[model samples]
Target: MIPERVLLTLDLPDEQASNQLGEDIAAALRIADVLLLSGDLGMGKSTLARAIIRAMAGNPELEVPSPTFTLVQAYPTRVPIQHYDLYRLGAPDELEELGFSEAIRDGAVLVEWPERAAEDMPKDAVRLSLSEKGQGRTVSIDAPVDFAERLQRSLLIRRFLDDAGWQHASRNFLVGDASTRAYESVCRSDGTAMILMNAPRRPDGPPIRDGKPYSRIAHLAESVTPFVAIAKVLRDAGFAAPQIPAADLDNGLLLVENLGTQGVLDAHGIPIAERYIASAELLARMHMHQWPQRIEIAPDAVHVVPAYDRVAMAIEIELLTDWYLPYVTGTPTGDEDRAEFAHVWEQMFDLLDDAEKTLVLRDYHSPNIIWREDRRGDDRVGIIDFQDAVIGPAAYDVASLAMDARVTISPELEAAAVDAYCATRARLGVFDREQFETAYAIMAAQRNTKIIGIFVRLDQRDGKPAYLKHLPRIREYLSRALAHPRLAPLVPIYRKAGIL
Candidate 1:
């Protein structure tokens, strides 16, 4: 029996608006999902499909030819997509010959003339019917349960934009990271752009310690409050954090300034030395400030930034055993090993407790650092992704930058950045190079250990295997840090776990 569908109708005023709707639908598509486009010839079915394919491919000029002759056209993207036209199909059974089942196995499928397939079409497919309406078109969508939810969310975003006086703006989906948040570039009719941050309030995961989720224990932000609060603080301090023009804190949505696309990385994906140095200087400047542990979000509202204390650090490092050890060794962590791991980490945390504390933007790596060439001094490096910011040891962020997990930092460049940062601190007042380097080594080891488990968890628990490719690089970083005399205590523990 066919299930009842949740229908949504939109009156697209022009081809531009129809393309925007296509982009919106494309952003919601997941792998293995099917979009069945049902419309008469020249009823804008191919036009809509092209928009979706182009948006997903991240190339506006991508050539997406009609699949009427070829039957199917596949595009390699972050989420692979296959566009199919069944207008020339000889029979419904011919789909099997054309590898229809295999085509949607690891990617999305957009089928035009879906009626030609009749009962062969999956019941879960999202069906879109377009009809001519004067000079434009009207689209009616019959969405499955999952697609219905996405449609509702998309409608909410449109309403929010309308309320914010950007009703005619076009939205292009921006690539997202491993977080639950997503982003979109909203371009106005005047060609100006703003970034839309779609961060829903994160629900607490299953309690891992003391009836608290890992997010709480790790001091991860639960909503947009931390981001809004921290961005305001950074901007007020003359740093280049985005300006929030409109926000729906209750719904966890925000429209902020679009920090240009120029990043700290070069075309070859290597970090630019000058940009990294500027980033280090920005960190030094940020460290020089006396940041409040609590900030006023509004007249009566307040946000208290959590401290990255022993418990938080311990929870983070525990990922090493909880995920990575089992993944690499193919055995669950035994009780005895767990006890030894805890003891070693406890000792390490004791050493970290005495280090100088500052507002540590937990992730201060290349991916999060934007290079604004038009800006000067500290402002030239625009900072983002600080919702997980915490009051922690200053060396934590410095190490995060120097031993960047996503990108390789050469030894020469790493030394130069460390020296530049220490020099800046020295000019400010008192700086102990040896003590800071020791702290840097400890933080690097700790951070890399956490990352090893994180990458494994992302592959096992989240079904994202791409992160596993960086495991070797992270292991190298961990090895380098553990070689430091201060981190020797961890060497035996890692060796015993067979992770060395």
Candidate 2:
């Protein structure tokens, strides 16, 4: 029996509406998710399944034949989709012999004739019931509560796209990072593709420190306004931030230009030295410019960039005491140690008072950088995803690049990237190499410490254990940063925590 909870009951008045629903489902699909398509014969079940499979594969013309004789067809898309037809199943128990369980475990599954193996069919799978209504069909979707909300959001995205005049664009899931935002690539009829960013307003988490949420303390972007404002700022500075063509400011949806797929990393996911150097050069070029403290994202709409003050920086480092330390030491950090850690970090921040200040794109790392081979010089680097930018020391972003949080950079490459940045800055104008180096070491250490804690929190609180594997790299980066003589006083604290 289907549960009382029904996500949506809509009429697929035409093939277009039905195909749009299929695209929506594919966009919201997660790994190991199962979707049961149920309907009477000729209810367009196969057509909807083909629509879904093609959307997931990002190929509208990919051949998706019925899996009746073969019983199953698996396409190795990014999330991997498996199509199954059980209309001719001899017995319910035989479902297992067809590798049904294994297929469901590996990736998303779409099953037709689920009733043939009703006893063996997974109970938690989302169910779609379609029935003929005159010349069209109506569908009732029953999904788990959390998934139901996701579907509702996906439908909202469709409406947003429709309002933007791209009603029939093909959708494909791009990437959803460790943030609240999700992204999709929508291809128009003319073959132009754009990024559809689904960054809803960030809800505040429970007040963790100083009666403010972690996002507020960290100066994270709470709404799409920041992204729009920051994008304008970067583009005005001559950097290649994505051009936002359409924005539903109230709804947190945007259709942006598709920056090319190439990035600073190679096919093997390792950092390319030349691209890294070019990215560093881009940062140096950006730093030499004077950014407006308040940017006009739209006429009469201004966004003021927040200052990355000591409170925010210090509170960020406390993630070490609050999350990472306890995970490693088997004990919650004492208040005394927390106080000392905060104090040392505050003192380090004091050094930044004399350092040059610029727009610190809080995450100037590899994931957000797009490499354009066709572009010239610094234009080769495309910067995206910097809604949390702040007015801070010039060295912070340099540190973000040198001690990349996602991938390990060899010592030689790190030195080369840093030197390339220094050379670029020197040529741009008067540059203080010594001061920048001092701040780089301290800021790099501070950022790495916060990342180590965040990775642990992602594992423990967010149920994402994959981030744990990067902990060692983060720790090593932190140690390398702490080795700086200017940060010598803070080394003892790390040593006492057995994190050196």
Candidate 3:
């Protein structure tokens, strides 16, 4: 026998409580959701719907009237909502004429008196019931199993914001990169805006080798501790990491300052050479300093930066053979081929013996670098995505910028940026041009190899196909990097493997 589904119940002591609940739900609203609200007349369904529509529109004063007479009212909000009132319906078949199914296809739907047409509702539709209580009201939500956790998390964020003194802030979802973390832009009535980072602790996958997950071996930041520690350090060191206004470290939530919307890319999504050079110069200045391996989030909590050792680099390169090569050629790799690939990278790792080491922001690419024109000098480069930092070759970041992961970098522009970085380093101290040259090429190839596999894995395993569009660019970047004379030993290997 199957168990009965459990519904989440909440008590609303006043209109403010109901509004907050509605706002929280609105924040997590997605296209194709059917919010079936069931309740009697005067049970505050309209009030809750109004709050949700207003929150989604990002305008608290937006007019949202009852659709009782019209049958349905569509609002062009962030997630377009179709508000429906089946109370005065002539028949259940009228829902088809009212465009209920059509609304579900285009955007989210909120329906009152859904029981009038219960058969028309989708199986996955979220069910909400409102009823009167002692001097207040109670709401019970029964979401589809898959959506229940997301609803709880969004509500938790609402509570977090309220506790952090941001009760009046309006929320709008912010698109993030290919990561599990989510972001929201919260603005107050006075036009004060801040970013809310919802970074939950991700569980590790099954151990692939030596009883450790790839995340652990590759030194991926499992919690926000690295971010908090690095942000404080970057701010202290005269960089542009966002300020943390409030934090719930235990719950993996943080309210951060809003760095400008501008990034290293232009309006057309192309890399700006001038801005790239400026960012490179900033990196030069960063490498000149002797950064510590241990970063302090608080006096009691310290995060130790991991070293980018041969093991870590080798594991990353394996992605090419494990996922990317298989995807590109549509053939599973044999043990012999995998062993040869590992051998090639192992031999190439020795070229970095004399490479300069510093705090390597592993993903120092265009997407992570914000261009703040209002600031002067290095301050213009606002670094926001650096949780996966490591104590590694300084040349890695320069390569990451010059041979960007997401955008195409022309050879002329790449050379100019590298020249700017070298010039800036020369001005500060005696720079090792020869050593950096080889290290940059090796790091570039390794990064692209890993990226190629990650993109394939994202599409195949994670069900995100957008990253696949960048595979050709990544392949081109890899070929360019592999051309460096320092990597000649592995040239034939790449050619033989059909990955060149």
- What are the candidates' C-alpha RMSDs? 2.2, 2.5, 2.5
Clashing pairs in 2: none
| lDDT tens digits, residue span 1-500, model 2 | 75445568988988988888889988778887888999999998998999899888888899999999988899998778889999988988887888888888889999998999888877788889999988999999988876788788899999988888898888888888888998898988898889999999899999987799989988998888889999987887778999998998877899988889999999999999999999999898999888998988788668899999888888788889999999998999998988888888878888888988889998999999999999997578999999899999899999999889999998888899999999999998999899989999988998998899899999989999999999889878888898889999899999897778
Per-candidate Cα lDDT values, in order, are 0.87, 0.89, 0.87
Instruction: For residues 1-500, write the lDDT of model 1, one tens digit per residue.
Output: 87767988898878888777776777787888899998787789998999889878767688989989989888987678988999999899999888899888989999999999879999888889999888888999998878888767776787788899888677777867788999988888788899999888999999988999999999999999999999989998889999988888888889989888899899999889998888997898889998988988887657899999989888889898899999988989999998999998788888876788899999999888989999888778999999999998999998899888999988888888888899999888787778788788889988998998999999999989999998888887887788889888899998776667
Of 1 and 2, the candidate ahead on TM-score is: 1
Query: lDDT (0-100) at residue 285 of candidate 1?
Result: 85
What candidate 2 gets wrong by more than 4 Å, as runs, is 1-4, 13-16, 61-63, 69-82, 91-107, 117-124
What local lDDT score does residue 114 receive in model 3, on the 0 to 100 scale?
90
Residue 414 deviation, candidate 2, in Å?
1.7
Q: lDDT tens string, model 3, 132-190?
A: 99999999998876567778889899889989999867787776567788889998778
lDDT of 1 at 64: 88
